[model samples]
Target: MCKGLATLPATCLKSAKDIKHKISFLLQKPEPQAADQKQMKEKTAAAAAAAAKRVPTAAEVEKWKESFSHVMNSETGRTVFTSFLKSEFSEENIDFWLACEDYKKSTTSKLTTRAKQIYQQYVEADSPNEVNLDAATREETRQNVENACPSCFNEAQKMIYILMEKDSYRRFLNSKLIQDLSQTHSDTAQMKKKKNNCDCTENRQALAGGA
Candidate 1:
């Protein structure tokens, strides 16, 4: 009877241990699920990275380069083209043509205004010796010509004009250009030396001038 009783308790203990082990295993199963989730996330991220690495087509780059080359070559043509770009035209090519039209209109207006002013001055002249009206008008005309010349304008406007002429071309220079240009590793020692030299010269000049 004693042996039977002892065997019953031992069997119960073994059953309880087996149940505990099964419960522990069930609890630990979520760990593998978490690992699997992490692995899946890693795989997904890798795939996305690979997709992002896809290079732009060679043909697209070539087309852009060709358009840029065209704009850089022509000055007057580019300028007239860019003015249209700043306007309401959707197509770049059309915008360039529109810019040309606008330029023509502006030029005509300026010429007409200048001519009328000159004619009025000539009619109102008090004497032939009192500054020949024609000579004064000629000088005025020359000055106007200098101001209206393309060389007198800013380079940005010139670039814009080129972009306007060729729809495929675009001038991307801006603050970004400055940032890119400034990214070089500068020599601090050289800069300091230049600054010291400039300061020294300024001080000597100030001393010599009694300032």
Candidate 2:
């Protein structure tokens, strides 16, 4: 009998017994195999991580090494460049460029409407997506919107391109994100060279053995 059992009601004694049983169950040690499984999992994870680190993806190698024009021409480059712009809080720059590109491609009937939309959204002072243009460029764009030609935004677009090329372009090249990509490309090239050399040597060895 427990020392406090005499003072407790029947219901209370039953509750105390349940609590003690639960405590004992909770205190029981886990199985040895469980620990071994956990260790094995950790080691496997480490090995997989090492393997992944040793191999760089082909897309990473290509995207990082591409020329600016090549990057702008493809959807992948646009996405990557847009992400870089967003990080710098200058996504409007790309938006303006894309808008200009679309504007230039529009049919004559649609050119006026697209040009106005581009100017109002990206050229006017204090507009939500305004590009960082000088006063002369902004004034010229404002004046051009009234006439709204296909080439109306040309000068402004050129300025924004120069801005991105001089500023964002350099930062992107120097960024750690791009640097890592460049490194991955270099590593991938080295790996391919080594693999080709190994294949050649193996072929030579087989030929000599056959002879």
Candidate 3:
């Protein structure tokens, strides 16, 4: 029989029970098959990661130099540009612009909801993700929020666009992402040159054997 806790503060008994519960929980390990499945998942993920590391080709990287519009147009370019902007803590500009682009497609009935969301998210002074706009532009956007239409965010969007095109776009061209792409281009060119030389040597050896 368990001893009665004569109300002498059964704290020690409670502590002993808590320790027993923790030990039981710790001993309840995952089954062997569960462990094997987790290991399999990790290995599959590593394989996929290896496959996804392919470097962009020189032509693809060069297209970004054509214009700021080109970088925004290419999915890969946008990803790289976004990464650079994130590093600089200025990703909100592109984010707001993209949001406006998507917002433009909202149906007439959905315009008000989408407009208010965009305004609150990226236009208001106290918004969690507010974009940089002049006080006039911010006030103008706030006033425009009531009658929401497809073009509600037009002025604000244009400002952010120009901000990125003029400011961040130039910086991106000189950023480490661009520098890394340039290095990859050079490396690819060198590899092609070496391969061409090897092919020429093989052709010369074949001709000599024929003679």
- Best model per TM-score: 3
TM-score pick, better of 1 and 3: 3
Residues 1-211, candidate 1: write the lDDT tens digits: 1123334444444543443333223222111123423443354334333432322132332333455544334332233223223232333333223222333334544644433332232222452112222444445534544455322212322443444434333443222221222221122233445566767887888898996
What TM-score should be assigned to candidate 1? 0.17
Show pairs that collide, candidate 1: 78-161, 78-162, 82-161
lDDT per residue (tens digit) for residues 28-93 in model 2 = 222223332344335433433343332224564365455566556655455555556766778778
- Best by lDDT, which number? 3
Taking the tens digit of each residue's C-alpha lDDT, what string does model 3 give over 18-108? 4334323322222223332344335433433332244445687788887998888765566567667866878778768877877787678
Q: Count the backbone clashes (under 3 Å) in each candidate.
A: 3, 0, 0
Model 2: residue 184 alpha-carbon error in angstroms: 2.3
Score every model by TM-score.
0.17, 0.60, 0.72
Error of 1 at 82 (Å): 8.6
Candidate 1, residue 115: the lDDT equals 30
